[model samples]
Target: MPEQPAGSRPTLEAVAARAGVSRATASRVVNGGAGVRQPLADKVREAVEELGYVPNQAARSLVTRQSGAVAVIIAEPEFRVFSDPFFEQQVRGISRELTANDSQLVLLWVEGPGDHDRIARYLGGGHVDGALAFSLHHDDGLPALIRDSRVPAVFGGRPGSGSGSGAAVPYVDCDNRGGARSAVRHLAGLGRERIAHIAGPRDQTSAADRADGYRDVLFDADPALTVQGGFTVDSGARAMAELLDRRPDLDAVFAANDLMAAGALRVLRERGRRVPEDVALVGFDDVAGVAEAADPPLTTVRQDIEGMGRLMVRLLMRVLSGRDGREAGAPASVIMPTELVRRASA
Candidate 1:
């Protein structure tokens, strides 16, 4: 074989000649080798290796009509995006799945409602094949925008009842309502009445469902026992303080997430409330470095956050591949189960 000059790159034609196959055959092998015989594919692979040839992604995408990339849109503040371990774990799972499928992951952060227009424009520009959206509030307009743009998307949680008329999108979420019920039942089984709840943002479906779970067990309980939180440590602390003031005789508390539970624990200790003694505590998400490290160790509800993230990717891929004919009806969603992790806090 003649050696090519320095600074010259190998092309499909060159690879085809070396492999003793037509350029179309070589192209088919390089582009996933579909419909090509194994022996021919092997020959093309050998030629590509010998010539050190790389397919031009841009040119290939034009032919396949696939960008070979997926977008991960986080509709939250920068602080929450970075500070929450939940998001980090979910992203890790998504990244792994996308890598396995030979796709690129593009992360887009939406700071507030004002950024929705820009995000809609980006999705409509055909820059990615699909998207996985997270941390969406009930009132968020981004979901409808995504629908209108015709970008296949999978949400990380059950979307809230938005004001728009867009059809329901597929989502992957933990069993928030069931988990909350389990927490409340455990406290009830322990004979702890007057159980109070510190709920996350009301607009989020997870928080709303969790609050619903709390009520499932305490339907007849006082409405004042429930307080709203922002799913942050500070918000948890403030909510707990208010709960104490509203119902000082409360015997137990179930925080929506572990971060809030941790905050509640701090106030409980400061106010001389003994965990599992005077006021049993339970949190959700079982986040590492938070729940287990709490003062008395929190007995919380555990959800497979990473698994949820991976499921989101898998669902989006199905939509992109049109494997299940997703558009015939409502997009399918997956609800992962949760369990109660017992500890000293409860």
Candidate 2:
């Protein structure tokens, strides 16, 4: 055979000719070596290396009816995406899992309702095989659009509607309610009464669930003890101030997430309330930097954020591969367990 010109891109035809096989056989081997014999697959691989060939993903996707990519949709403002360590850990897990499966991740940040149409169109355009969505609020219409687009999806938390009107979507979430229950229980065990809770945003299921857990423990507790927060440091600090003003004798607190806990800690210090001495404190998520960095080191409910991310991908991949056995209904959901991590704060 004549030597191919240098610097020219190698094609499937060239690789097939070099391997002494049909183009169809070479294509199968290049895609995944599924049905082709071992010896022939080896020859095709060798030929591919020799010619420095690279498969055209766009062309290959069309033939296989698969994009070999997954979308990671974060339905939050840009600030939250950058500031929240929870999202960072989850994305890391997702990236690791996708890399292991030889799939690509397409990250899409939905800033608001205005971006819904664009995101829906992109999902409907057959850009990815499935999606992993996080930080979904109740009023967000992205879920409905995702449903309409008919793309397989797995949520990072329990799926619900802001207006209470949508069907449930498959999701992988840590046990927010259970984790909160454990945190509150620990405070109770420490004999800290008048316990207050700094809850997360009411629009998200995670915050709602954690609040519910607190209510379960403090059934007859004063309603004024619970203050709403936006899961930010400033919100937590403000909420803590409000709690202190409302219930001066409150001896313990549970902040929905670590960031809020850190905020509350600062306020406690400013107010001259000693952590775990004058007042006990507990936080959730056990975020690496925030929880451990607190002056008194927060005792927190540890959720496997990365594990939840990995589990979301696994579930979505199952649905995409048609192995989930759902009989053409809603996708499956997984709830991971949470554990209480002891520290100096509580």
Candidate 3:
């Protein structure tokens, strides 16, 4: 083989010459050898190794019309994303799945409304092959922006079109309503009357579903028995306080997520409320470290947060793989199951 110049990047032509093959054939081999014969691929690889040649990723993506990267967008503030174990679990699953598939993960945080335009431009620019978005509020315009960009995307929770039309968007979410129902039923079985619900933000579907589930159990549900929370521990504590003020006789409480439940636990502890004995308590999400660490170990609804993340990436990948780079005709949205993990709190 001819000696390469000092400080010069090895070129494809040199590898092709060393391999005794056409440059196009060598290119195919270096770019994953999809149709090249095994012996020919081996030869190209050997030549590449001999020459210390590295295929330029930008040029490769241009040829394939694919970035070979996937974006994981979380529509939340940095504090919440960093503090919440739920987001951490989801991202871990996404990273694992994307890594196993030899794809890059580009994490994006939508901190403010301005980020939407920037994210839309990024998606439209073909910077990533696909996107996995999560935590959309009903009023959030992300779904519309994504649809306009024409990039295949899968959401972690059921997302509205940011318009009231409720246009279709493929997603993977757990059975939130059913899980809430189960939690309420358990509390009722404990013979706790005046059950109260601490719901999350009403604009998000998951929160809305959980709230609806609470109402399904208690038809003609007392308006005062339900208080809204922001899915944060502080919000949970505040909402719990409001519930106590409204109905001190309330015998049980159900919070939308474990974070809020943990908050409620603190408030209950402060107010001299005993867990399960004086007032039974339950929470959702069963987030690691939050539920089990609560005084008296929380009994909560468990959704596979990481599993849902993996499934979201899997679904978007399927759509990205569609023929002619178009979506594969909208594969049906998926809803994963949830469980009511029994523990000491209940």
Candidate 4:
């Protein structure tokens, strides 16, 4: 045991000298010992304890050529990122896995097209080892930019086409179309006819897929029964009003997400429509606080939002492993299952 002359921070060199091992052996032990034998690794650990040695992350990055951090790029503005519980839950999952792997999470958000240049520059700068992005739209250029930057990246949903006909980036998404079909079918089973749909913006993959599911169920129904929404409470309220104006006799409503569903519920109450009595209602995403807190608890399609985020990180780790020879294979894109949860609203 050596007492430090109270001075500067301890370095790897000091730990190596104390352990009677080369700087390289101490380096391997400090940076998660892999090829080193157990007894020698233990000796390095004891030396590190006695010397209180700390590895310099910047220097370590130069040695390993890995930043030891992962970027989480969300394409939404600041307000929506703060308001929406879906992103919150997904980020929680990502943080949990990143902590386990001793990696850092660098959060990057895009407010508009103007921010793309800054984001593109950062991705190419190698500040983080990889990135996980979501909430893509048709006009957003992140998908293509991510591809061209050649950084290991994963999408949170089924990706839209980016750039030319090159290979598709891996992604983790839920069964959005199947979930919407299940919700609409549930309403139909309850003997409600003329079910109207309040759909999300058509540009997003989730929204487009949900709209397709609604059409699949009501293929030959009147075109006026569907209205577009912006996946917001205010938009839901506005769309709900429009639907009533177009089809006052409709007996059911299916909202794309829980926030919109909550908004639609407000409009329904304002218009003096009863839930499941006059019009059966269902929504998707089963978001926390929004769904159950509705006037009557909502029966909606449930997807594993946090689980999807966690799975995205796991997939990215596999890809990183394949690149670095730690793991043997990369993963293909994943689509998780969804289910209908029965509650009072439906």
Candidate 5:
């Protein structure tokens, strides 16, 4: 490398020379690798500060063949993932675990059509240590991409898109159907009949599973209830609005997520209806913003979003360490539990 004039950035060689160590040692120290002694490590640290050295991630990735990083891919709009409390909580959990393990987290937002192809290329090219995929839909073709990559991957939920019962890679998921059932059953217990459901996207396992739970319990309870919604607030609002138009006597609504439930409430309020008095509403995901900010508060099904993120990281670490529980003849699906939070909505 060419020597620079005064005030230029320091290279790895400069740090190595200043620390009286090899360039490789300087690189390792900068990347946070273990095994360097305190004296040498201290020298490298001091030299790094004195020289204002910064390690190039791409160069380091080439040397280690491990980026010291992982990617979290969500198949949804950036706003949806960024705005939702669930994503924020999960990201915090994921970051906590990754930072503890000395790894970095990279987030990839895949919302546009044909973007999965680009993502597949990126992952397949060995850009990340592994990948964590979430919110897959039926026609998304994401599973096939990950399957073809041969890189280690962990899904957030069971894939509702494919016929395959089990995953080639391990997955962590919440008990969606059970949670939905609990929410709907609670509404029934409140003596609210003519219930309508604002469901999640049909392709997502959480959405389908939750919708199924609501449908099964509602049919068993009243046999006249129905469901609709695609897990968005707009979907919830539209579904709620339509249900009200069709069945003016509908007394209850179950939304697939808090955002959707919030939408349903807005639509209800707009049409001059009272919540819990005119129509009881329930939502899943117990997201903080919508759950707490609703007109009369929201009754929602809650999952440990942060725990899920941490658990996913743990599973990936196991894979990287070659001690994966499922691969070691343990149970495959690690299903996390859910809770129903009571509020004024239902």
Candidate 6:
């Protein structure tokens, strides 16, 4: 036998010949594609292991037109991405679901304004199968870009109507409005009329939806008292303090999320306001850690983030398969439900 060059590498044909299978079958087996017979698949796997065959992503993409990878693009601050428990849970859910399907998850962080164009290029590059976008602001054109790409894509939450195209963007989101209502209703059940809201950023769809829920519920109740606290700890503290100053008679508060609620709780303690006694409080996204660690514990709304991740993947997979046939008017919304978790706070 002739000796190959020192740096020469094994190719798909080499593995196919060794496995006694066609190159196409070897390719399918190596790329984890379905429908391959078990014995042939095992032979290809054994051949791959013996020869140390590594499949070229470019070649695979050429044949399958799929990179066997999905991108999860998040535009939040890096600190928030790493530190937020809600984000942690979301990542876990997404990871678990994607891994089960033998697909890769690419986490892209779009930190500054400069990152937008680069993100567009990455998505347009045909290097990924699809995308799951998160943390988009009101005016960000990401939704439209993803839609126009004609690639399978799903949003983590609704992007607001700042760009007009947001209304038609396909997304998988928790029922923020309904969850917020449940939280408020629970507080109302405890006879807390002077309820205030520590809301998230108005630009975000989740924040806006949550605010709408609180507003909708409060409108039906007797005195409509409310305020907005941008979705941060400091914002919540400041907003809670201001609300207390304005309405010392306020008896309850509904923070739009658990982080904001935690902040409000700290302020209440500092101001010597008794929890549940003086002001019952409720929060959204029952982030397990903060809920358990809160001074008086917390009552919160819980959404199955893992289920959302799995469902988003399934939807995107359907889009990838061309089963639904992507069209402009094919129902651009996928809303998930939420539930209230009662505890000492409310």
Q: What TM-score fits each model?
A: 0.82, 0.82, 0.84, 0.84, 0.81, 0.81
Clashing pairs in 3: none
Q: What is each predicted model's overall lDDT from 0 to 1? A: 0.89, 0.89, 0.88, 0.88, 0.82, 0.81
Residue 322 Cα positional deviation in candidate 1, in Å, after optimal superposition: 0.6
Q: How many times do residue backbones clash in model 3?
A: 0
lDDT of 4 by residue, 123-150 (tens): 8877788899998777688788777777
* Candidate 2 per-residue lDDT over residues 1-346, each given as its tens digit: 3466876778999999999999999999998859999999999999999988889777876776588889999988889899989899999999999999999998889778888888988898777988889888887776677777777788888867543334456889889999999999999999988899999999899999999999999898899999999998889999999999999999999999999999999999999999999999999999878998888999999999998889888888777766345456566688899999999999
Task: Kindly provide the TM-score of model 6 when superposed on the true structure, using C-alpha atoms.
Answer: 0.81
User: What TM-score should be assigned to candidate 5?
Assistant: 0.81
- TM-score, model 1 to reference: 0.82
Can you write out model 3's per-residue Cα lDDT over 1-346, one digit (the tens) per residue?
Answer: 5576777988999899999999999999987759898888999999999889989876877777688899888889888899999999999999999998899999998888878888888899878888888988877787777767777788889985353333355899999899999999999999988999999998899999999899989877789999999999999999999999999999999999999999999999999999989989999998988998888999999999999988988887788676365764767889998999999999
Per-residue CA lDDT of model 6 for 1-346, tens digit only, reads 3355787878999999999999989988998999899999999999888887778878767876788899988768687788778777777788888898888998987677777777878888888998887777887676676766666787788776754442244678999999998988888888877888887887898988888898888875433355576666777788888888888888999999888899899999999999989999998888868876888998889888777777777766666665345543434568888999888988
Give a tens-digit lDDT track for model 1, residues 1-346.
4488998889999899999999999999998868988899999999999998989766776766678899999878888999988888889999999998998999988788898888888888777888898888887787777777778888888877763556557889999999999999999999998999999998899999999999998899898999999998889999999999999999999999999998898898899989979999999999978999888999999999888888898888778767345445545888899999999999
Q: Indicate whether candidate 2 or candidate 5 has the larger lDDT.
A: 2
The lDDT of model 2 is 0.89
**Candidate that beats the other on TM-score, 1 or 5, i.e. the better one:** 1
Superposed model 4: Cα runs more than 4 Å off: 1-59, 163-167, 326-329
> Could you give me the TM-score of model 3 versus the true structure?
0.84
